[model samples]
Target: MKRKVLSIILAAALTGTMLAGCGSSAKQETPAVASDTGAPVSEQPAESSATQTGTSGKQTDGKNVPELTSEPLTITLWDISTEDPGKTTMEEAVQRFMADYPNITINQVHQQNDNYKQQLVVAMSSKQAPDMYIHWGGGPMAEYYKSGFVNDMTEMFNTYDHPDFIDAAVAQSTYDGKVLAIPFGGLSGCDIFYNKTIFAEVGVEVPETIDDLEAVCDKLIEAGYVPFALANGSKWTGSMYYMYLVARHSGNEEFDAAYTQEGSFTSDAFIWAGNKIQDWVKKGYFPDGVNSLSTDDGQDKALLYDNTCAMMLHGSWQVSGIRADNQEWYDENIGVFRFPEDSEAAAKGVPQDVEIGTAIGNGFSFNCWNADGSVDQTKLDACYVLATQYFNDDAYNQRRLDNGTIPSIKGFENTIDDANMKVVADIFFNASNVQLWYDQYLPASVTEVHKNCMTELFGLQKTPEEIGQEQDAAMKASLAE
Candidate 1:
C-alpha cells in the first residue's frame, strides 16, 4: 500500500505577529535571573512498566503519561520560517497536531531569518519568551543552556523512540552529554556548488586540491567569469571561505582548542586562512562589490544562475531555493562538491579528506524554565507533543524531504527522490569530519570579531595577523566574562 505523505502547501499561514523587533543589534548584558535550583521545577517522570508504541514503530517505556488536562492550554512557538515552503510545512503540521489534540492551542510565531537569533536572545532574556523556539544548535544554544534559559530534554529524548534520528543531528543538539533540544528539520553543511555549463565553457573540471581549485579559478577568470559568487554584506556568507580555509589548515583539534580558550585564536592556521582569502580577493576571484552584496537579495545567486559566476560556496539549505526558482536549470547544470583540500595543509600532515564545515541542523528548544525559575508542566508537555509531531512523525519527515530538506531522521534517504538532494546527502554522510560554522561555533562576541575581520580581510583593510589578533582579543574578553 502506498503511504499518504503530508502534502506541503508551501503557503502555511503564520499565526502570530513578530514579538520582537528585527535587527543585528543584541543586548550585551545577561538577563537577571535567580540561581539554578539544580533541578527542574516540574516533576520528573517516575518509572513505569507500561510501554506504548508510536506509529513510527518506536516504543516508549518512559513514565511520561500522554494524558492532557481537560482544561484549555495555549503555547507559543517562535520559528525562522517566515516564508514558504517552511512556513507552510510547519502550519500544516500544527493543524494536524491541533486536530489530534483539540484541547491545546499553538500560537505559531514567525520571524525573519536575518534577525531571528538576535531577537530570540532578546526575547529569552525578557518576559516575552515563547514556550518553545527553533534555533541552530551550537554555541548560542550552549550559552542558553548554561544560563538555564532553556530546559534539559535529555530525559524526554531518551523516553521517546528515536530510531530514525540521525547521530550527527543528535550530537549537534547535545551539550555536555545532555540533550538540550529536539532535532528538527534538515542537517546542513557548506559545500561547493558550481555551474557545470560554465566549467565546460572554461574547459575546467571540479578541483580536487587547493592548487587545482586556484587553477580552475584562473581559467574561469580568463574566460571572463567570476570564479566565485560571494556576498559579504551579511558577513557570514563570506565567513564560509575563511572557515573552510581554517579547517583545512588547522583541522578540528586546534580549532576546538582555540574556540574553548585552551589555545589562542591567533594561531598560524587562522592567519594562513585570512591570507588565503585576501590573496583570492587580490586575484579578482570574486564578483565586484562582494563586500556590499546582500545574500538575502539573491545577488550572489544571480551570478551563478546567469553563468556570470562559475561557483558558490554555501550551505545545502540553498538547494530547495534553487530548485524552486529554476528546477530545470538546476537539474541539468548544477553540480555539488566538497571544498577542495588545501595543498599546503596536506603537505604539513593535515588529513587530505577532512571537511571544513559541520552537519549542523535547526531544532526546537523548550522554554522549560520561566523567569521565576518555575516550569509549567502543561506547557512543556504540549510543546513536546508539537515538536515531536513536526520532527519525528513519519509524514512530517516525508514532508521535509519532499520540500528539499535533508531530513535528520534516519531512513529518510530511501524516501528522497531528488537527484540534487541525494548528492548533498552523499557528501554529508561521507564527510570525514564536519565542524560547525565558526560564527555559530564560537561565542557571540568572538563571532562578531571573526565576521568583522573576515570582511576587513576581503576588503584589504586588515592583514592576516591583525585579523587573528583581533579575534584572539575578542575570545579572551568573552572567556573572561
Candidate 2:
C-alpha cells in the first residue's frame, strides 16, 4: 500500500506529469556540519540529517556518519495505487519527508500493479530502469535482483534504528544469501472473509474443519446463498484456494519442498488437494459463473455484498475494501476466519497454514543510476533513511491500519480497530505454523504451470492421473531450466 504512494512520487518525477495535484517540490535544507578539516560538506548533520533523525537518541560509536554534499539530488521512483491525487497517506508521508530535507527530491510515480510489472520488465531489460521501483516479495524479487536491477539493502539494515525492522519482511525479500529489497510490511494471504449475518441466520458456527466447512456450504446453498466468492477467470485469484490447501494439508515442509524443487508440486499432498477442489466445485460451493468472473472486477465484493455469498478467501488487504465498499454491510454482517484444515490432517497434528500477521507488504527499492559514478552516497543514505524511518513511523502504520491493513513493523500491531480483524491478528501472531503464499515462493513460470494444472483439474480437462503426470512434467521442465 505504501509502495503505491512512494511509486507515485517516483512516477511523477520521471514523467513530469505537471499535474497541479503534486505539492511543490521541496527544497534542500543545508545545516552546516564539520568534517576532518575546517570545511563543511553539507548543512545537514552526518549523524542526524535534515530529513533523518537518529531514533537511538544516543549516538553510539562505530555508527559511521558519512559526510554529505551540498548538491541537490533527485531520484525517480515508481509505485502503484488505487488512490486519487494527494489523498494517499504515502503521498502525505512524502510531503512530510520533503519538509525535513529540502535538497533530496523524490519524484514519485504510479502505475497499475499488473501494468507496472509488464512495464518494469521492459524498462529494466532496456537499461532504462527507474532510480527506484516497487517490487513484490518472493521469487520474482530474487530473480530481479539476480538480473542486476535491484540494490542490496544489507548495509541499510545494519545502520537503521530498528535492526529488526526488516527481519520479518526479510523472509520474503531475502533469496539465496542476498537481501534484495526493503520490506514495506508483511501481509496475511489466507483469510476467509465471511458474512456474520449469514452465519447467524443459517445457525451455523464458523467451520472448524473441512467437513464442517462442506456442511456449512451445503446449508448455505440450500438456504439460497452462494457459499464462496471465487473468481477463477482472474487466474491468480483462484490460486489463493490452492495456497490455502497447500498450507493446511501439506504444511510448510511440503510447500518449501515444492518451492525448492518443482517436483514437489506433483506430490500426493498437492494432487489430493487439487482433486478435492474439483470435488467441491462439483458440489457447487463456489459462486455461479465464477469461472467467467474477473478477480479485479469486484466479483468478490459483489458476491459478499450483493449476492449474500458466505465467504471470500483472500489476503488481509481486502478487509478495508470490504468495509469501504459496504461498512454497514460489514459491521452488521462481515467477519473473517481461517480456512479449515482437513480433519484427517488435523488429527495427524498437521498444522494449519496460518499466514504471518504483521507481515510487510511488497517493498520498493532505491535503484541509483550512477552513469558517471556521481550518485552521492549522502543521497543514497537519505533514501535509506527515508525508507527505513518512514516505513516504521507510527503515522504511516496507523494510516495503513485505518485503511484495514496489518503493519509488519514491530510494536505496530495495535493500530487495528476491527473486532473481526482482531481474531485474524490473533491467528497470525499466535499461529503454530505460518507459511508464505505458495505462488509468492515459486518461479512465475512454474507457478503458471501449476495454475494450468489446477484449471485443467477444475474443468475436468484432465483426469486425476493426467493432472498428476502433467504436474510432474511441469516440475521437471522448471527444474531443468
Candidate 3:
C-alpha cells in the first residue's frame, strides 16, 4: 500500500513531458552530459567524497566499513548481459573500476538472462557464490536476505556520497529494512515498438484501444506481415503479453488479489487474457514456433529487422538493444507507443492507466561472506566503492546514454536526446502505478511454475482452465509454506 501511494505521488510530480515526443526522428541521438563526480577516483583525495550528504530513503547500513588498503583483493561479479549494449556497458564499468583500484581484481562474468537465477542458485549451493551479483529485487531478494546471502549497504551509503536515485529505486533495493542492492540502470517500462514504415504501408493508424489493435493486426496479416515478433523460447517473453493483457482486461486489482492468494487465478480477467492470446495465435499473428525461437540468440529482433513482423511488445531496453545493432535502421524504422488500453474494461470502471514495468532495472547486490560465515570487511568496502562510486560516475552514465539507456540515478533530464527514449521516459514517469514483472516479483519456486505455465499456455498443450488451476494450486502451497 505504501509503495502504491508513493508511486502515485511520484507519478503526479512527473506529469510533465519530455522535449521530443514519439513522432520525432533520431537525427540527434547523442547528447552531452556534464558528470557530477560525487564519488572520487583513487587519483583524488578519497576522504573528500566519503562524507554523508543526501538522505531521502529507508534502510540503515550500520555495518562497519573497513579501512582501504593496497592489499590484493580478487572479487567475482556475476550478471546477465550476454547481448549488446548491456554486455559492453557492464564490461566497461569493470575495466574502469579496476583502473581506479590497481590492486582489486574483478572477475566479471556474464550469464544468459534466461538461466541466470538457476545458475546463481547452483553456484551458491556449490559454495562458489560471486562476491557481487545482479538481481531484480522482490520475493527472491527477500528470500536471499533471509537466508543471509545479502550484505546491507546502508552503512556504506550513509558514510559515502552517492548519486540521488528515485525513491522507488531505493525502495525495491531495500529488504528487511536494509539497502541490499545498488541500482545499476534506468527504469524499464514495457511498451509496443512498431515498424513505422510497415504501418504507413498498411495504411493503419497507431492503436488507441484493444479493438483498434486487433483491427491493425488483421490488416498487417492481410498484408503478409506477422503482427507481433515474440520468441517464447524464453517463457518470460510470452509472459509480457499475458501481463499487459491481464492489466488492461481488469486493471491491477485482480493481479494484486491473485498474487496474494486472496483471489483465484482462474478469475474472469486471467481467463480473458489467456483467451485473447490464444485467439491471436490462431490468427497466425505471431512468428511460427515462437516458443522455439530464442530472444537470447536475437531471434525476436531478427523478425522485426527483416520486416517480417510489424511490432514487438517488449521492454524499453529494446530501444538500446536495437540501436546498438544498427542505429541507422532503428532511427528510420522504430517508433514506440504505450500498450493499447481495454475500452470495455475502462468503461466498466477498471483503472486503465496502471502500467507494468520495473522502477529499477538490474541491481547489484553484495554477498561479502567469508568461508567461516562472517562478513568480509575488505571485500565489502571494495564493492561499496565500486558500486556507489565507480559505477555511478558521469563517464559510466554517458556510456549508458550512448547505448540508449537512461540511468536510474536522477538529473539526466536534459541529456535524453533520443526521441524514443524520451517517449518511454514520459510514459514511465507519468504512470499511476508500474507493476513489476511477475516472474521477478514472485518467489523462485512460484516463478518456475509460472514460466512453465506460460510455455504450456502458448504451446496449446494445456487449457487456460488447467493452467489457472495449476497456478492457483502453486500459489496456495507457496503461501502455506
Best by lDDT: 3
Per residue, candidate 1 scores C-alpha lDDT tens digits across 287-392 of 8888999898988999888888989999887888898899999988998988888877788888655564444367788875543567766677667667764444
Off by over 4 Å in 2: 1-69, 82-87, 162-167, 356-358, 372-376, 450-457, 463-481
lDDT of 1 at 44: 27
Predict model 2's lDDT versus the native: 0.61
Cα TM-score per model: 0.84, 0.80, 0.83
| Candidate 2 global Cα RMSD | 10.6
Task: Single out the weakest 10-residue window by summed lDDT for candidate 1.
Answer: 10-19
lDDT of 2 by residue, 122-210 (tens): 67656677876676666556556645566666555544443233245555556555555666544554578888888899889989888
In terms of TM-score, the best-performing candidate is 1
lDDT accuracy of residue 252 in candidate 1: 69
Q: Tell me the tens digit of each residue's lDDT in model 3 across 6-64.
A: 12122111111101112211111122234353221222122433332122231112212
Clashing pairs in 1: 12-88, 164-410, 357-435
